[model samples]
Target chain A: MMLEFIQHLVNGLSLGSIYALIALGYTMVFGVLQLINFAHGDVYMLGAYIGMYTAHFFQLGQNSSVLALIFTITVSMITCAVVGFLIEKFAYRPLRKSPRINVLITAIGVSLFLEFSGQLLFGPDPKFFPQIFKPSGDWSIGELKINPLQILVFFISIILMSVLQTIIFKTRLGRAMRAVSFNHDLASLMGIPTHRIISYTFMLGSGLAGAAGVLVGLTYPKIDPLMGTMPGLKAFVAAVLGGIGNITGAVIGAMTLGLAEEFLVGYWAPTYRDALAFGILILILLFKPTGLFGVKQTEKV
Target chain B: MKLLFSSNSRHGIASLRNWILALVLIWMAHFFVADEIDPYFFSIIMYAGINIILAVSLNVVNGFSGQFSMGHAGFMSVGGYISAFATTQLETIYPEWFAHSFLMSLFFIFILVLAGLGAGFVGILVGLPSLRLKGDYLAIVTLGFGEIIRVFILNIDTIGGARGLPNIPALSSFGLLYSWVVITIFCIWRLVNSAQGRDFLAVREDEIAAEAMGVNTTQAKVRAFVVGAFFAGVAGALFAHYLRYLNPQTFDFNRSFEIIIMVVLGGMGSLTGSVLAAVFLTAIREALRSLQELTRIDFRMIIYSLMLILLMLTRPNGLLGTRELIDFIPNGSRKKKKSLESHP
Candidate 1:
């Protein structure tokens, strides 16, 4: 029983890390624009497709190591950054001054557009991830076993998240982003170039989502147009759980959600895993509404 | 608070006239359309009727009330299950009456009404807490609620699990569906044009301001959700009987979005607009059926989604905006939809 618990904990951490990566995109965009950016998940879906292609063309899937995975993640992130940039430029930017609901509806439209078009372009069938890094089998400690792919997913996600933190807090552009998130009009009044900062936020957030897509593929190995739907929703729940706009809150919320889901799948019914996250979302919104780490602001009546 | 058939209001007369005309048209459809119409065409018309009900009901919450609800399909699915379960259980007890009889049809309508009430109850549960949250949060919570319903239904074994509940009795006829549609539109139209409806519109325009005006914004918002849920439930019951199957997947977020698209495209808060868009979109979708078959790809959904974004960019007020179709029916009476602050 103890070994099984340890195994689920490890599994949870790895899964939570990917969710955190995606949740960052959701939280960042909501922080800056107050738009949920529903297409962010589909952006992650595109990332996996990009990674798959890069692997196929470069012949890196077979007999490749960490370098192959690194290159693939880099290419996917760059491509996804471009995709995210265009989406924000066209889909969202046009409705900046519109009612928040219009932007939201447009976001949903973009999400559906990406999902269906992905099916059109990528074909409806699920593709097997190229397996750039071999799984290296299982390593056992006592009765508990750890999968190397899960370890890789965990290590990569942590490193990326830490880098994100440093950039957001440590750099000049990062400070600009924070300022923009604080107040869009005020930041613009202060000559912060709000549009450019918003663009940068999308790029950074979407880049992380892309990285997550690749990592998820590395672990799960199956990729499809519809793959983003469930994970995207769960990641949004994670973001909400963490206190929507709070960066660190996203990670913590995602970890909690991951552990709960993994434990449910491990001991309880697997079918309830998706519902549990949403159930948590409703409860959190009902009681707290601000999320675990989110700072509350009094609404202007 | 009394609306529709109440003889006091000036607008009531016009709406009552419209309802009578709708009733006549439905009667005409039962006799003319049902018998002479091609089966394919008849089916499309039936679907259009269902879409009309769904769109108008959704418009109650999204259009008139100003609360963004993305989980209407969840309410609809709940209602569908309720009616389906009750009827199926009733079938075992009264196999002969459930087969082909006036008694069975009456019982079916009763079950559908019950479904609407059941769904409305669930909507209250979804809406009460949701009202405390603001715009985007409300939308997300509703979205989650819809997914939770779907996931919950998927886990249940009695309702056929992931495979879906099948073998629902087909009781939908031209008269039945449009009668419900007309009633739904009439009820919603009356509700919106009523004294209470002004509060709903006010809540939509500005919740804080509405609250200050003693509107009881929470009650108004919940009212919208409940009413919307109730009609969505009715629509679901009709839809289940029409299709004679129940896949929880059918009522996923996509279905809710499609209904939203209809409400938006028809011009939010416009009852006639909802009807027009429902018919127009259903027709367009039916036409697109050939394209889907030819390409074997779902470009129809792609186009529908793209149109939503483009429409929002160009005309966020939707095609008809806030004006009624009756405003255009008479010569020189057609007036432009007032450009509200929400649009700009």
Candidate 2:
């Protein structure tokens, strides 16, 4: 039982970190645009499929595994960043001045378009994600066992998150992003190119989501066109849980959600697992709409 | 009070007569119109009624109250299952109870109301919490509520789990479904014209300003949710009884988006638009069913998504926007007056 408990914890954190990565992307775009961007999930799905193809072509698992992993991640990230940028430019940019509901509908349209297009292109079958890194054996401490891949997943996620934090806080572009998110009109008045910042934000967010897509494949090793639907929704829940618009809060929320889900599956019926994330979402929205890390912004009359 | 009530008495009597005359006409169509149509065309008309009810109800919260809720499918499934279980179980145990056509129809109406209330009860649970939020947050929360409902329903073994409760008696005939559709559209239309309904629009237009003007935005929003969910439940009952099966999967987020698409395709705040779009979209989809299988390009949905994107890009105001159909009629200046009052 103790071993089982530890197993759940390690697995949960690994899963949570991936959610955090995806959630961070969600929160960043939301922070700047105030748009829900439902198609973000499909973007992540596209990332995984792209990663899968790159790994397959390069024979990532058969030769120079680490280099192969790096190449796969880079290719997927760049491709997804471009896709995200184009989505904003063509689909969302025109509707930026429109009502929130209108943009949301367009996002829904984009989401369906991507899913169906992916289905038509990818054939709706789940492919075994190429394991670029050979298992280096598990280490056992007393009754508990931990895999090296789990540790790598944890470290990689932390590195990416820290890098994102630096970009959002320490860089000039980050400053512009913060400025844009705060007030678009004022930011533009202050000579910040608001539209450019919005595009960059989408690219950055999509790139993070791509990294998450790869990491999730590394963990689960199964990729499908529809795989991102649940994770994307869960990551959105995580972002909200941590208080949307708060970067650190998103990580915390994702971890909390990941652990909660694992524990739910470990102790209760597995069927309740999916419902648990959404249940937490409702409770948080009602009780703490600002989220664990969010500062409530008052409505300006 | 006497002056206010008496000034419209003559017109009120004439309108009441017209309503009765229309009802009698519809009742006659039940015998003649319903029986004459082929099943394929009949299904299309029935589905149009269902979609209209769903769309119009959704408009109260989304179009009027300005909340971007996406949980109608969840509420719908709840009502569908409840009415399915209650009516089917009652039939299984006491087969003779709903034997007479007149008595059975009344019983089915009761069941639909019960289901609507069941759905509305869930709506309160969802609305009370989600109503506190605004904009996209509300949308996600509502969506989360929908997933929660679907997951919950999916786990319950007694209700057939993931398989779905099957073999429900097809008690929702054309007349029955049509009447409920008329009833739903009428009730919501009346609500849209009420003083409180105006408050719903105020909240939608500008929540902060509406609050400043002393409108209870929360009350108005929640009223939209309850009224909308109530009709969604009724629609659910009609849908389940008509299909004679209840699958939890039938009420997924896709279904919710489909209804939203219809509402937006019609015109957010226009009743006539919702009805027309429901009919139009359904007809188009039905006509394309064969081509969908033949071409295998998934062109129908691709075209749909493209329409949604281009519609927002070019005509985000939707087909009719905020204008009711009556406003287009030459003599219906009362609608013009109402529009001016609401907007002003």
Candidate 3:
């Protein structure tokens, strides 16, 4: 029983890290722009597809696996960032002055566009990603056995999270993004091109989403256009659960949600797992409208 | 007090003429469009009318009332399944008692309306808890409620669960569907023109100000949500009877988003716009299906998405916004007066 519990914990952490990555993308964008980038999930989907193509192109199934994996990840991230940038430049930037609802609609439109476009381009079949890494070490400590891949996923995710946090708090671009998110008008007044900052934020978020997509692909070994839908929604829930604008809160929320989902599926029927996440979201909203860490903003009449 | 129709009596008269013309055109289209109309086409048209009802009703809450509800499909599914069960089961159990055609149809419509009321009751139940919350929060709650309903339906095996309820009798005909569509449209038009609708508008425009003016914002919101759910329920009943099959997947978030797209594209807050947009969108979707078969290109949905994005960027208020056809009609005397004033 203890061994099984430990296994579940490792599995949960692996999944939790992916959710945290996606949730950070969501929370960061919401923090800066106050606009929900509904297409973020589609970007993740595209990333996975791009990775699949790269893996196939290089014949990585029989070739040098590590180099192929690195190439796939790099290409996927770049492609996703480019798409995210274009979407912001054309669809969102034009409507920045419009009502928030209009922007919301545009976001939904972009999401739908990406989903269907991906479907059209990739055909509605789930493609298998080449297994680039085989678990090298199976360590048994007491009753628990740990796989190398799980540890790798955890370490990579932690490194990415730390890198993101450092960029947001330490770098000049990150400072500009923070300033823009706080008050776009003030940021613009201070001569910080707000539009450029917004674009960069979207690119960064999409890049993170791309990395998460690649990790998810490696773990699940399946890529489909619709695969991102559920993960994206769960990540959004995680963002909200953590207080939408707080990056650390998003990570915490994602971990909590991931663990909750795993335990629920393990203890109960798997069918109820997605519903469980939504239920948690409803409960959280009922009690704490600002989320676990979100600052409450009062509307002025 | 003047009657609700008095303020815009002249515009009403002109609108009555236009509505009559539109009705005539619809009848003509129904009659002359085909040499031998298949039952399939009739059913599709009937479903289209039902979709119009749902889309328009949703417009009342999401568009006019300025609420973002992604749960209209939940109310629709509730109404559809309940009404289907009622009409079919009650008919089968007591065939001898309800043998009369008129009585049976009346019973069916009655049960359907009651089902809609039940859906409205559920809507109120959902609405009351989160009516005080802000827009995004309310959106999340309603979305959660929608998913919960779907999950509950999926779990209830007695109602057929995930496989869905099937073998329902075809109760709606072309005439019946068209008539209901007319009645629903008229009812919505009247409601929007009434003082109640003004309160709804006030709430939409500025909630705090509306409350300050004694609008009872909570009550107004509940009323809009309940009424919207009621009509959605009716639409669902029509859908169940028309399709003769019902599934939980039919009421998912995508379905709700489709209806929302219809409302947004039609111009939120415009009754005529909602109806027109629904018809246009349904037609476009049908056209796309045919195009897909011909070209072997499955990018129709992509086109739709692009269109939606383009529409938002160019005309965020939608094609019609709050303006009705009557507002644009050439009022010769008013035009002359305006010209005279400008010249002076």
Model 1, position A102, has a per-residue lDDT of 89
Candidate 3 lDDT, B1-344, residue by residue in tens: 33323435444533455555666666666567633678666555666798799888998898778877878999999998898888778667887855676676667778778978989989998888767766665765677788888888898887789999997777765655666787677667767666888787888877888899999888888988998999999889888988899999999877887888888888888777888888887777776777677655556567667877988888766777765544556662211211111000
Q: What ranges in model 2 sit over 4 Å off?
A: A61-64, A136-143, B1-14, B291-299, B338-344
Give the candidate order by descending DockQ: 1, 2, 3
Clashing residue pairs in candidate 3 (N, C-alpha, C atoms within 3 angstroms): none
Candidate 1 structure, TM-score to reference = 0.96
Model 1: native contacts recovered, as a fraction: 0.78
Report, to 2 decimal places, the DockQ of model 3. Answer: 0.45
Per-candidate clashes come to 0, 0, 0
Check candidate 1 and list the clashing pairs: none
Off by over 4 Å in 3: A64-67, A136-147, B1-36, B95-101, B291-298, B331-344
Question: Could you tell me the TM-score of chain B in model 2?
Answer: 0.92
- List-wise, what DockQ does each model earn? 0.72, 0.59, 0.45
Against the reference, the lDDT scores of all candidates come to 0.88, 0.85, 0.80
**lDDT of model 1 at residue A44?**
94
lDDT of 1 at B47: 94
Q: What DockQ score does model 2 reach against the true complex?
A: 0.59
Q: Write the per-residue lDDT of candidate 3 for residues A1-301, one digit (tens) a residue.
A: 7777778788888888999988888888888878777888888888888888877787776664556667777888888899889999999999888777777778878988888777778877778877766565587897678976777777878888899999999999999999988899999999999999999999988988898888888889888887887788789889999999898999999998888888777767777776877888887887886899999988786
Give the per-residue lDDT digits (tens) of candidate 2, residues A1-301: 8889989999899989988988988899899998878889888988888988888887786764666777888898899999999999999999887877788889989988888778778866688888887666788888678987887888888998999999999999999999999999999999999999999999998998888888778878888877877888899999999988889999999999999999899888788888888899888888888899999887665
